[model samples]
Target: MKRFALFALFVLVAAVLTSCGLYNSKMASDPADVETVAVVEDAATEQAEETAEPVVAATEEVVEEAKPAEPQIFEPGSFESPDRCKNCHRDIYNDWKESMHAHAWTEKWYQQDFMMAHHETDGATDLLCGACHAPIAARTGQLPPADGSMFDETAKRGISCDFCHTVTGLDQMYNMGHVSEPGNEKKGPRGDGRSLYHGVKFNENHTKADFCGSCHMVIHPANGTHIIDTWQDWKTNWYGEQNITCQDCHMTPTPGVQETPGRAALLGKWRDNMPYHGFVGASSYVQDAMGNKKQAEMAREYLKSAAEMKLAETVAGDGNLALTVEVHNVGAGHKIPTGTTYIRIMWLEVIVTDATGKVVYSSGLVDEKNHVDPDAVFFRVQFRDADGNLTGKSWRAQGIGYDRRIPAKGMDSETYQIALPAKGEYQVSTRLMYRSFTQATLDEAAERTGEEYPPVESVEMAAAQTRVVF
Candidate 1:
C-alpha cells in the first residue's frame, strides 16, 4: 500500500507540472512538430489515467498578463467644491479658506509674476506654473486661457479639499507631478474612519514628505535650473536624516513640533494630532495684505521662531567698533526663507544709537519709499540668466548665481565696522529681518497691472542688543 501511494503522488506531481505548461513550453515552439507532440501528450495522459486508478483530475489556473497603469480620467467639474467639505470639516475648512493654498491661483502677486512669465515665454510657463497653482484647472484642461476665463468655479478655489485627498500618486519629484484620482474614494493618512458621503482609504503618500515635495520643488523645464529647492534642501538636512517631514512643521499652527488632539472630521474618530490647515510660513506680508489677520499673526510667529540672533562687539581705543551679528537657524527644519527665496529677502539690520537717543548708524532700514537698503547683507538667492547677469525672475534662470541662506541648525555671521564719533555707552542693536518681497517687485507689479499694492514691511525674526563703552 505504501509503494502504491508513493507512485500515485509522483504521477500527480508530474501531471501538475505538465499542466502548468512547464513541459510543453519548449515543445510548443515548433509549429510543424506541434501535432505529434499533442498526440504523444494525449496518449501519455490516457495511459496515466488507465494505470493510476485512484488519482484525482485537476485544471490549471490561467494567469493574465499585466498591463501598464493608465492615468485617472475624470470629467470637468468632477472634483467637489471646498464648501461641500465644510459640512463635515468646519474647523479645517475655516483654516484652509484663508491659507495660501486657497489663494495660490487667485493671489495678485502670483498672478502678476505668472502673467509676466507667460508673456515673456509666450505661454511656455503656463502649464508649468498652473500645475501647482491651479491643479484642478490644469488637470481638467481648463488652463490655456491663462486668464482663467474658461475655469470652472471649483477650479478657481485652488488646491481645495477634494484635490488633495484624491491624489492617487505622483509622476515625479518636482514641477507638480501629483496624480489625481477624483471620485468618491478619498485617500489620506487614516482610512479606518467611516464617512457617510465618501469612502476613506489610507494612503501612505499623504503622510510622507514626498506628497508636499511634488509641488514644493520646481525645476525650470527649459534649462533644468532649480527654481525652488525647498524639498531637496530639507531632504538633505539633519531633520530629514532624522525622518522629520515638512508636514510635521508646516502643517502645525506653530513653528516647531507640537501635537494638537482632535478629530479630522466632525463625525470622525479622534486623532492624536490633526493637521492644522492654516499652512502658515514666512508669508506675513501676503497674509496681512490679503486681510488674513489671524493667519498673518501665525506667520509672524513662525518667522519669530525660525532663527535667533547674537551680537558680539569690540571697542578699539581709536574709536573703531567692530560688531559681529550671528544668525542661527534654530527652529526651521529647512533653510531660513526656504521657499521662493528669489522673491523673498532676509537681511541683517544694525542700528547703533548713542546714549542721548540719537540714531548714529543704521543699516538695512526701509527707506521712505519702503525699499530695503540695496547694500545690506541679504540672505537670499539669485539666478543667472544666459548672459550671466543676476536675475530674480525664475523663468529666465539658466543657473544659480548667488545663494546665501542659513541652513537648518546652521549659523551665518556678518561683521560691521563703524567708526564712533564719540563712544560712551553706545547701544548696538542687531536684528535679522525678513520680507516676502522687495518694494521693487511690488513697484514692477503695480507698473504692469496699474494696481497699487501695500508697502512690504519687514518682520523681525530675531534680535539682540549689546552695550559698548569707550
Candidate 2:
C-alpha cells in the first residue's frame, strides 16, 4: 500500500508539470508575456497567462498608433493670392514684388527659353521647367498649354508667399521636390506669433538649407545630368560644412549676414532678425530689364562683394611680360555665378598701357556688336550633347564638357604672356567682369520670339592695377 501511494504522488506531480508546459507553450504562441514566465508551475506563471490576451491586444494597439500620418494635399484654387497676403505682410510683399521669384514665370528671357524647350521637347519640358517657375500652375494642373492661358490669377504670381509658406515636406533634394499643403495653416521658421486669420506652425525646414536647395538644384530627368548644381556645390563646400545657408546671404539686402530687426507681418511680434525677401543674386540685368531699380542695385552689390582681384607681375630681360591674376571668391558661399551658369558668364578683363597711354594688349573686351572675345578665358559652365559637341543649352545636356568656376573661399589664377613693344614702367589694369546673360543667348531669344531686348551690360566685380617696369 505504501509503494502504491508513492507512485501515485509521482504521477500526479508529472501531470501538473505537463499542464504547466502546455500553458507556457500557449502563452508563447500569443504575442505577449512569452519571456516573462518559465515552464515551472508557479503563481507568477499562472497570473501572466491569465492576463496574456489583454496584453497582446494592447501591444497591437500601440504598434498601430506608431505609424506616420498621411500628408495633406490641397486642390486647385485653395491657395490665396499675394494681394491678400500683402494686407498683413506689407514690407515682405513689397520686397518680393520686384524679386526674381516674382518674375520667374512672367519674365521675357525665361519665357523665351521655356517656350523653345517646350517646342523642341514636344511639351516634355513643360512640367519640368514650370515646376519651379510657375509652381502654382504645375501643382494645380493648369500647365501643359506651354502658356499662361490656362493659369489663374494666383498661378501667374510665380513663387509667392502662400506657395512658399504652405510647403509641408520634400520628396527629394532636387528638381522642385517641395510638397505643398495649401490651407489656413501657415508654416514658417517661427511659431510664437499670433494670427487671427490663420494658424501658425513652426517648420524647421524653413530655417535649414534644404528649403532653398530644392528649387536651386536642377537635374535632367531623362539623362540624369545635373543641369544646375548650385545646391550640390554649396553642400560639398566649406560653407555647407560651416552650416551657412543660402538664406543667410541671399535673403539679406547685401552680401553676407545682416539682420533686419522688425516684424514679418504688420501685426506680428517684433524680432531681432526678420529675413529680407528680395532674394538678391547675380541677376541685376533681369532686374533692370524688369524696371526694378532697387533690386538691381542690390543684385549688383552682391556681385561686387563676391570676389576680389589680385595682381602678380614678373618681367623678363627679353621684354616678356608674365602677369598672373588671382581671382579670390571672398564672399559667395558657393561658386561665383552659381545659378544658370550656362547662360551667365564671369571673365577676366586685362588691359596694359605704356607711359604714352597707348593700348599694348587687351582681353575680354566687348566688341562693337556687343560680344565678348571668343578666345577669352570665361569662368562659366558648359555641357556636351549626345553627339559630344559642346553646348550652352541646359535642355540638350548629356554630360559636362567645360566647368571652370571659382569655388567658395578658393582662388583661381590665370597667367598671361605678352611681348612688350616698348617697356617704360608699363601700367597693367585688370577688371573681373560679370554678365547676367550672354549676348548670344539674348540674340537667340530675339530670333525665336520676334522681340528685341537691350544689350546685357557688364558689371565690374573687382579691379586691380600694378606698375610693371622692365
Candidate 3:
C-alpha cells in the first residue's frame, strides 16, 4: 500500500513539472507573455529577463534612428570663397578687384599705419584699426591678437569678395560692425536672385542710411567719447527728416543721387539701377594711390559739394573790419571728415588781401609743424588727456571735451572783426579745407622713410571783395 502511494505522488510531481516546462516553451516562442509565464517557471523567468532587456533597448534605438536631423544654422565665417562668383559674374568681380574697397586692408599705407599702431600699443589696440581695414579677419576670430599671423590667407586679402557678400546682418552703424551669414547668397542693394545656393534677400535695412552708419559712426571704446558721430548728426537733422539714405548720396557717380543701370549678377535679371560698388568718397589720397584719376576727381568734386560757404558782410566798425562767414553742411549725410577723427581735419580759412595782389593777412594757414595757426578760429573736435590737457594724438586721448561738428543739413556761422590802422581796398576770402593727415604726421613719415612727400590739403573757397574808404 505504501509503495503504491509513493508511486502516485511521483507521477503527480512529474505531471506538474512537465506542464510548466511546456507553458514556458510556448511563452518563449511568442515573447509577448514570457514575463507572466516565467513567474510560474522561475528558471525560464531568469532567461526571459536577460534576453528581453537587450531586445527592448534595441527596438527603442531603431525608432529613434528613423527620424531625420535638423539642418544647421548658416555661419558667415564658413563662407567658401568669392572666386566662385567670378565664374559667372566676371565683370562685377573685375570692377570690385580694382576698387579701393578691395585693397582697404592690404594697401601699404594702411598696413604701415596698422603695424605702427600695433608696435606702439604692443597690440593693445590693433583690433581697433582692423575693425574697418580687415573686418573679415575680425569676424573670423582671427583678430584681437593684432599680429595678423594667425589670420587665414582669405582674411589677409582685406575687404575681398567674400567679406561684402557674406554680410548677412549688421550689429551697429558707422564702425562697420556686421554679422556675417556666409554662403552663396550674396547680400547687396538688390533682393532678386534665382540661384539655389543664394537664400531669399528681403531686408530693406540694406537700402538705408543705417547700413552705412555701422562703420561711419564710431565711439571711443575706453572713454565713452564720441570720436566720430556722423550718423548721429544726420539722424538728428533734415537728412533724417527727408529720409535720405547714405546710398542716395554716396553710391552714385554723382554726388547727390543715383542713375546707374545694370544687372546685379550674371544669373540675375537686369535692373534699372544698381548700387555702384566704386564707393567714391573724400579719399583723394587713396584714389591717387590707386591711380584712379577719375575717382580722385570725383572725390574732390564730392568734397567741393559737401559744404557751401557764404560771406555775408564786410564793413568797418569801430576802426575794425567785421566779416561774417556761414558754412552749410550741404551734401554729406553725416558730419564732414567723420571716420578716424584723429586723421580727419576740417578748418576755416580767411585771407585778407590788399591792392596789387599783396597779401595783408592770412588765418587758418597750416604751419611747418602742420599745426593750424593759433590765431585762427578752428572748427573741430578736441580730445583731452587724463590730466585735462588737450591732445592732438587721438590714440593718447582719454576724453573728449569739445566737438563743433556741423550738423547734417545744418549750418554754422563765425564772425571775425579785425582792427586795421590804415584802410585800403581789401578782398576777404573764406575757405573750408579737408585733409586726411596732419602736417606733423607727414613730417614723421618723412623722418621715418627719409623721403619727403608734399603735404596734401584740399580746399574749398568762398570769397567777396569790398572797397574800404580811408
Between which residue pairs do clashes occur in model 1? none
Clashes of each: 0, 0, 12
lDDT (C-alpha, whole model) for all candidates: 0.76, 0.75, 0.58
Cα lDDT tens digits, model 1, 9-78, are 2233223322433224333344321222112111122322233212111111100111111223356788
What global local distance difference test value does model 2 have?
Answer: 0.75
Backbone clashes in model 3: 12
Rank candidates by TM-score, best first.
2, 1, 3
Q: Considering only N, C-alpha and C atoms within 3 Å, which residue pairs clash in candidate 2? A: none
lDDT, residue 464, model 3: 41
The residue ranges of model 3 lying beyond 4 angstroms of the native Cα positions read 1-77, 80-84, 98-100, 172-176, 196-200, 317-319, 366-374, 421-423, 448-454, 461-470
Residue 284 deviation, candidate 3, in Å?
Answer: 1.0
Tens-place lDDT per residue, model 3, 148-225, is: 777777767677776666565665453455666666566766666667656656556677787767666654444434
Model 2: per-residue Cα lDDT over 307-421, one tens digit each = 9999898899999999999999999999887788877888889999998999899987888877776656678776655555445666666556666779899988889998898
